[model samples]
Target chain A: MPQRMARVSWRLLLLGVLFCAAGLVLTARLAQLQIVSHGHYAVQAEDEHMGMEKVFPPRGAILDRNGYPLALTLDTYDIYINRKVWQDEKLAADGAEALSSVLGRRPDEILAALGPDTDGDALVAGSIGYDAGRKIIEMGVPGVKATATIVRFHPEGDLASALQGFVGRDQTGLSGLEADLQDQLGGSAGTLYFERDSMGNPIPFGYRQLTQSEPASDVRLTIDRYIQEATEQALDAAIEKNAANGGSIIVMEPKTGAILAMASRPSFKLSQLDLADETKMELYRNRAVTDLYEPGSVMKVVTMSTAVDLSLVTPNTTYEDTGMAYVGGYAIENWDFSANGTTTMTQLLQKSLNTGAVWVGQQIGPERFYDYAKRFGFGEPTGVGLGGEAAGTVRTSEDPEWYPSDLATNSFGQGISVTPLQMITAVAAIANGGELMRPYIVADVVGPDGSDETQPQVVRRVISESTARTLTAMMNDVVEGTPSHGARVQGYHVAGKTGTSFISVPGGYAPDRVITSFVGFAPVSDPRMIVLVKIDEPQGERLGGTVAAPVFAELAPKILSYLGVPPDAPALVQQGG
Target chain B: MSALDRLIARPLPRPFPRVTGVRPVLVGAFLVVACLGLLQVAQTSSATTTGYNLQRLQDERFATQAGVHQLEAEVAVLTSIDRIDREARGRLGMVPAGTALTLEVHKQPPEQQFVPLRFLSETKAPQVKTSSWWQRLLNLLPFF
Candidate 1:
């Protein structure tokens, strides 16, 4: 009996020890969860039970030189549908139909977006108006939701659209200056944290924390709103009247290299940008800096400037125009296929004589001509602070394709290509007193507290002040002295050249279509603005003098007045020697 | 009146004897419960005030933001070039002047102004629009 009692006692003791071991393990686990790793588990629990949200700051504003806002942000709401809440197919269809009526979207499309297979929420429509969003939310639909969002708005509509460009649905820049200055315009985002219930609804009087977002900075451009509007209106009228395919105009402050105005046709309003339309996408290109053309007789200024800068030729220097010049078996003739026997440099510019240009190029020699061209910024980018800027093509005598005849054709503005920006920037050197200024469109950046000013930069001096003045005087005669040569801006001493080039076909030049252009600067005594008007393929009158010159005559005076420049000309013509 | 008489005379007396320390234990338990109750009331009132303050601040912030947004939108529309031009032409009855600036390029060039070669633009004098040296330096900062 005593032995049986001992066995039972031993068994009882073993059971007590096992129970104690289990109790100790439980206590250790409790301590670990409640003390050792409390912070980690507590944070995890808070994250799981609390609701969080991402808040995106408003994108930056794009303003004109005068602080007029061109692009800005507006508060908007996006409608979404909760698929889980409206799991029933019929309920989902009914909800979609109600939303469709309010949002002006197809009910079938909304239904497909929130179909039974969907697992989460779906956006019904973006940028819904406040009234519309409120009405939809009030419909008492099972799954309807509305969240606040920010959208980009352009109040100026299509004015300078090609240059200002447009943003996407989420305020992402797609082209032009918007694309170039994306980082400065897109600000950093932040987040919000708060407690939530089992239904994922924000808990009333719940714990809340906020990490504030930084607002984007504002960009102020050198584009004067007044000038840009006037340019657009003038270019649009010229395009319609001439029945030309399209056109572009660039106005610049020669001294500052500040782009006062840039306008192109076929531009659309930012608010109405439709990316799906192919034609709209085609018009998205900024033609002033992107399109290339032969530039025709407008190039004569470069050839003449090259010769005059070398002191090899003067305005009175005589050149013989034999109607046709032979170089490497290639015949280079005047534009009308006829030429006067003897011509002065002034008369050659007035008439845009091709043979005269070739004679001047011959006087300067190929080496000097090519060097001057390079100095004038041909065959290089102007770095004008715009996207899609094209550097023109220029070939020297070293290339295998270089023929003796190219000197004649290139001097007369053919067998090479140039963008309007390049052409104007180079010519601006002559107008700006020999200094090649780096052209920029942005004037400064103004944030909330202070402003950052953009100082003008000089690339290099291309000629002496005397040479630029001399060239300016010779060009002046092209408008005022030439008989019926056109390109006259009344009340202004305008110096410019006209170009009419036949559109080059695959093998040779087109017989019918032509590109006409007029480039000039005004108030020869002071030189305020350099203007270039390029019209492509006008219907009736195709000469640069007839089609493009009048546009300059129309735009130059208005721009000068807007800039507050007083008229430098006397009412009566001065009697002179 | 002796001790034996007092013990027998006290009828329906304390079930827990004083010497057993039951009275102090009961009093201590009562005090702890009252203190806990008072602390809970104070905590609840503070949380309520905090919640109210948060809600009011959020509402005020939203209202201010809305006002700013409205004013910004109005400014954008009012400052638009197209709007200004239309107002000038329609409401103000303005007419355009001539199509050219008066300049004479025909005759012999005037005694050339002693035009000097300038490396940079001479149009805007640096002193005209800028502030003090410290202000200019501060303006250069991106987030000044």
Candidate 2:
């Protein structure tokens, strides 16, 4: 009996030891959960019970100068399909059929786009219309989901497409002013945190934190809706009439340097955007700011103005023209290749005499000519607040490839490249009493708090007011006297110059192609607007006065009349007449 | 006398007094716990209901915002220049003015003129025309 009792006691002692070990393990686990690993478990619990959501703000609208919406952001949806549901063939077919019906696509097409059966969701359609998306959601399709998204919509269609630019799939501005002023147009996104239930619904009385989103500022561009429409129509007509490759037209308020209308042809339609087509991407650029071409006789205006400002020559200053002027053994002749015996500075412009321009450049010399060119805002971007502005090339004497012929050619706007915006802004200085103004496209930015108006900014005084007036009179005479002057307004004194130059190729110049352009401002006394029209590779007529000046004539009269500037004295008869 | 003897002797006297089964402190603790449990249940029910209501309201707000966005898009399309031009040319039989006629009225220069808020007074200012209360009530009626 004593032995039996001893065995039982040993068992009890072993049981006690087992109980003690179990107790120690429990205590350690509890300590860890309550102390050492508390934060980890707590965070896991919070994650299960709490939720975070990113609150995206709406992108701003781009408006015209008259507060009409040019481009705006609108709510849309991205359709998604559950790949897990695709495992059930019937459900997948039903979902795809419903989506295809709403999206105007075949069910087989939709199914093919969804790919093989997978576990996660797949995007079926992006930027689906708002009404259709809402209808799909309300239909309660088993495997289909419509998630909210935003898309940029241009109300005016392709009116100023290149200037307004466009947004990508993520609603980010990709080009043009839309890309340039992204900061102001794209507002800051916010975050929201709240406690959620098992089904991911917010708990009514649960803790909530919110970081309020800042709304985007509405940008008002200086583009006048009517003017822009007219400019586009005119450009389209000119391109069709000339059977030309492409062209660009820019109309700016001379005094303020406000771009009223900017249009480029070979532009893609906004309603017909296809990102897959890489070739059309080139058409998406605003060529008025991006394309560089020799301004031809347009630069002669700059040269003549520079000479007049320096007192080196006047409109009456006489130069003997033998139909050819030789510099570095390179002969420069008039556009018609027939020069008058003794041509006045005014008559030089009337005839568009390249020989006469060369003579004037010789008088001013290379150093002062280039200096004045720089002063006139050439060889630099006009700072027009547009993306992809080219600071035109000017090969002055400082460069290695400089030649004496370059000086003569550059005088008449060859061997030099300039964007249409730069050329217009340069001539606008002559119209603005020689004060170069910084050109701007955006006129106002209206935010939630208030509106900010962009005040007119004067770059600098490049030439004297007297010289500007004298050049204006001379240009007016050129317009009135030239036989091919199609830029004349019925009852206005138009100051203008025509340009026609051969397009430069790899080695020399394109044999058959020519770029014709016209730069003009109307009502010579007040000079409210400046217009530049450039056409590339016309099939038949190629002279600026013939091809490009007529386009200016078409758009300018309408613009001036729209501005309510009463007509000045009636135009004078042609010199030939 | 001894304490045990006294107690035995005292209990036996008269009709024997019965002792209560429950202690006061235990009863008090039970009552307190029950009340607390009921209160917790009530608060949870209220909070859950509120959460559902808040969700519904948020959904409504989102729907309204979406509707506003839709209307804005529609208005933009309708007012777009392309649409206007098409409607004017095709539907309304209207053409753009071929000749712009200018009539220069003799008036004060822009700097010297007080234009007299013509646009505001003509278009925006609310007209304070005399109206009977009966007419106003009639105007509120859909048929009227």
Candidate 3:
């Protein structure tokens, strides 16, 4: 009995020792995990809890010459989703429906935009206005997030829509002056590293890291609102009166080459940009610098100016007009085929005689005349800092198929194309005493502060001062003397020319179709502004002198009055003379 | 004989094992080091989060300032007097009416007593024109 009792006691002792040993091993394992491997587990946990993202900085605004806002940024918002926070399919669907209703979109469309079964983080909506975003936040939908973004807005709506252009959804300039100065207008984006609470709300006194952000410099353009309005009104009136397709007008300071106003008819509204509307897109093209046209009789001024500059002819140099001039076996007739026995060079210009222009071209020859055209900024872009500028076509002397008829046709502004800007700028060169000032709309660039930096540049001198004076005087005769008599404004001496070119059709120049234009400067002695008015394919009165000249006359007086230019002479005397 | 028996009584004691293992001292040092490291990590994380928030607030303030300036510029442009005048006159062709052409001739003699009554009438009647329609109606109720 004693031996059996001792055996039971020994087995019990062994079981107790084994249990104690297991407890010691478990404690040792706990110490190793808590002390040695703690850092690895902690890092993994932090990665799951914390997140960081980069934030874009504020972009700058575009100002007019007078520090008025043309383009600016406004605070906007975007909607996002957290897949983990969304409790059920109903909650997700309801949130999307509420957003779509406020955004004026279909539920299915919003759903499609949110994408297919996103994991945790996904962008649901973009470019929502502040008020709409606020409303969505007020609703407090689970898993939905609202993020702030910057959006561009033009307050003036359609005013200068084509000139100032518009920005895209990504805040990049897409066209017009905006596209030309994109880098200067776009600021650097900054990074934002911040810790948030479990609810994704920024906690007070929370940890954050930020990089310094540089604001974009402001671009200041020289466009005047008043002059732009006047030009637009004048062009609109002319277009309506002529029943023409469309037209363009450009006004500039003759001496400075500062473009005061540039307008095109059928202008687009910045607020109503329809991407699918090709017709509206076509109107957005600035025809003043982009589209090239046969400048018609306006080209004769260049030819006449070249002749007088080279001393090939003087104001009194006489030519006998028998109604036609033959060049390369092709006969070019004067406008209306009016035959005059003998006419002075000045008289030929006053009448816009086609044959007379051809005679001057013949005297100057193709090479010299083409060089003069290039010097006057024809057949090239003006580098006006606007997108879609055209380098007009001027036939070269070295062309394989160069013909004398090409020169003759070009002399009267046919068989060659020039943009309205080129035509008007060349005229300004004559008015501004031969100095070919580089035309620019942007006057200066302003930094974040009020400080500004500007570099005024001039292109080159195209003609001698003496030649410019002679050309001005001869053009003055055209405005005041005979053909352009109707275009003379009261109490001001005007210098201008008229053009009525037959448009090119499938076969040849369309008989009934014409593009009439009038380009002129006011107070010829010291010109303040150069104005160009054009009308395309008028239903009636195809002559520039009859249609475009009256519009010029009406616009000039108002422009002069608005500019506060006192009358240089008595009204009746200036008008009658 | 009793004294000799008491003196002869004696006793023996059990022996004990020596505690010479290093486990207790090593565990104690590891626990102390882990507590100190945890405290340092918590402090660093808290400082980083606070610094990040401060910087983000500053950036937000700057952006708001830029926005305010931009809006002010826009307001100035939209309310410019020249732009308004051009739109009114050029687009609408509105001309101001001259007083010379619009003036009407009165064919009645002045109806009032001279001196004190004239002053009272002039002062009190001018208020009638500036009042609201309801006030004017209340004033005209006496005539009915």
Candidate 4:
């Protein structure tokens, strides 16, 4: 009986040992899962259930020199589709159709945009317009989603359109001042991450993460909005009055190289950019700095200035005009084809006598004349910070195409091409005491907190102070004298040159087709501002003095008064001069 | 044993006597823990409110900056030269007339010229005395 009892006890003990071994194994497994591999399992769970996404921050604003908003970023909604959320193909199609109806896009196009052939993670629907996007969001389509994006807005509409330029849908600057200062204007994007609920809505207090977005710095331009509007108005009027192709107007503070106003006609509104309008897109080209033209009699100013500066001729020096001059077997005639005998240098300029300019060019010689032209900022970019600037064509003396006829024609502003900005900036140099100031549109880059970095640059001194003063005096006589009496503005002394260049077509020079241009500074006694107005291919009167000069006369007084510059001279006296 | 039991035994309570001190101490400890938890919740909620307020204030600051910029741009456009010219030329019927006058003069005594200068003290001394009290009162009132 005792042996049997001991055996029973041993059997019990064995059962107990088995139970203990099972408990030890279970504890080891629990330790491995709960402690050793906790992080791994936690990460896997997060990946399957929770999602985090980064949101981009707002871009910067563009301001004028005095803190006027020229370009700005406004929050806009972008509609998108989640294909996975759609219950079926038909539901997705219905959602797309509904979105397309509001977006003004064809149903097929919207379907294609939302179709599942995308290489990206999400299928994209068409970007709806702001109004449409807002309305669609209100409709509350189940699978449709909306994201906020920053879009560039120009508040003044088309004012300074060509200079201020436009940005693409991607928020990148495409042209003009915007393109040049894009880096400074485009601020760094910020990131935001947060935990989302089951409905994919951001939780108010769940794992909130934010990186403060550095808003883009504001780009302050030298352009005065008021002056820009005036310039556009004047240019439009001139274009209409002449019935010309198009026109450009530039106004600059000669002393500082600050472009107060720069305008080009046939411009497009930034808000209405369409890909199909090729002609309108072409009009966005800043002709003042992009398109090259022969400056005509305006070139005479440079020649005369060079001669006078070199002491080759004085204002009182006489040159006998015999209707025309024979050079390189070609006859270069005056505008009227009639000459007054023994005209002084001053009278020659006032009358825009081609032969007189040729005589002056001869005195300057070819090498020195070309050198002076280069010094005046011709045949070079003004470095005005606008993209697609052309450094006008200057036929070099060493080129195989060089001819004596080229020199003779170039003397009177032909056989050479120059952009209007180049001509105006060069003239500005002459008006501003021969300092070739680097013309710039963007004056400074300001931060969101009003701190700023200004890039005010002065290129070089092109001519001596004395020479510049002398040239200003001569140009004063040209505009104030009898022949150009029409260009005289009341209450101001205008120093200007009129250019009537014939357009070279397939045949010789185009008949009745001319580019009439007037470039000058008002209150010439202390030239504060310089202006240039050009009219292309006027139908009726094509004379620079008749067509372009009067425009200058009309605009100068208005601009002067607007700038708060009191008349240097009395109104009636200025008109009489 | 019966006689000893009778001698040692007094009246005993019918139900088991309840322990008083230990129960109260445990209850008090539980209450203290509950109070601590409530305080923690309050502190966390206040911190969250402060954070929300800070965020709201930042948003307001940004909005104000945008408004100021917008108004400044409007002012610039309104005060632009072109608009002024339109008003002056179209509405005022003004044209630029260039007539200048030069006053030619012979040399005169340096001190004999009439100078347009006014002594502020002499001009407004009585007025200043009359308004001094009111000015001081207004200065003392910050809102005014």
Model 3 misplaced stretches (Cα beyond 4 Å)? A1-54, A80-89, A92-126, A131-140, A191-213, A276-280, A449-455, A572-577, B1-63, B66-70, B77-144
lDDT of 3 by residue, A1-577 (tens): 9899899988988888888888788878887778788898787766555546546555667776677666777767788878656546688688778877887888767666656665666777777766677677778777778786777766554667788877776667777777778777776666665667786745446555677656687788888766776778788888887788888888888888888889886667788887677666676677788888898998898999899999999999999999989989988888898987698998998889999999899999999999998999988898887889999998878887778799999988998888988889888999999988778888887776665654545688888899999999999999888843768887789999999898887878888888999999988989998888888888888899998888888888777777766556553332221
Evaluation by TM-score, superior candidate among 1 and 3: 1
Please give the RMSD to the true structure for each candidate, in Å.
Answer: 10.1, 8.4, 14.3, 9.5
lDDT of 2 by residue, B1-144 (tens): 589888777765587667776677679888889989889899888887887798679767766776787787789899998899899999999998886655555555567446667544556678789899999999999977
CAPRI tier for the interface of model 4 = incorrect
Predictions' DockQ, in order: 0.18, 0.18, 0.04, 0.10
**Clash-forming residue pairs, model 2:** A204-B51
Model 4, A63-141: lDDT tens per residue? Answer: 6667666676655567666656653678867777787778777867766775554322243543434455657767877
- Sort by DockQ, top down from the best: 2, 1, 4, 3
Q: Model 2 segments beyond 4 Å from truth?
A: A1-53, A93-113, A129-140, A192-210, A570-577, B1-40, B103-144
Best by TM-score: 2
Q: For each predicted model, how many residue pairs clash, with residues at least 3 apart or on different chains? A: 6, 1, 9, 13
Q: Candidate 2 chain A: minimum summed lDDT over ten consecutive residues — where?
A: A568-577
TM-score of 3: 0.75
TM-score, per-candidate, Cα-based: 0.78, 0.83, 0.75, 0.71
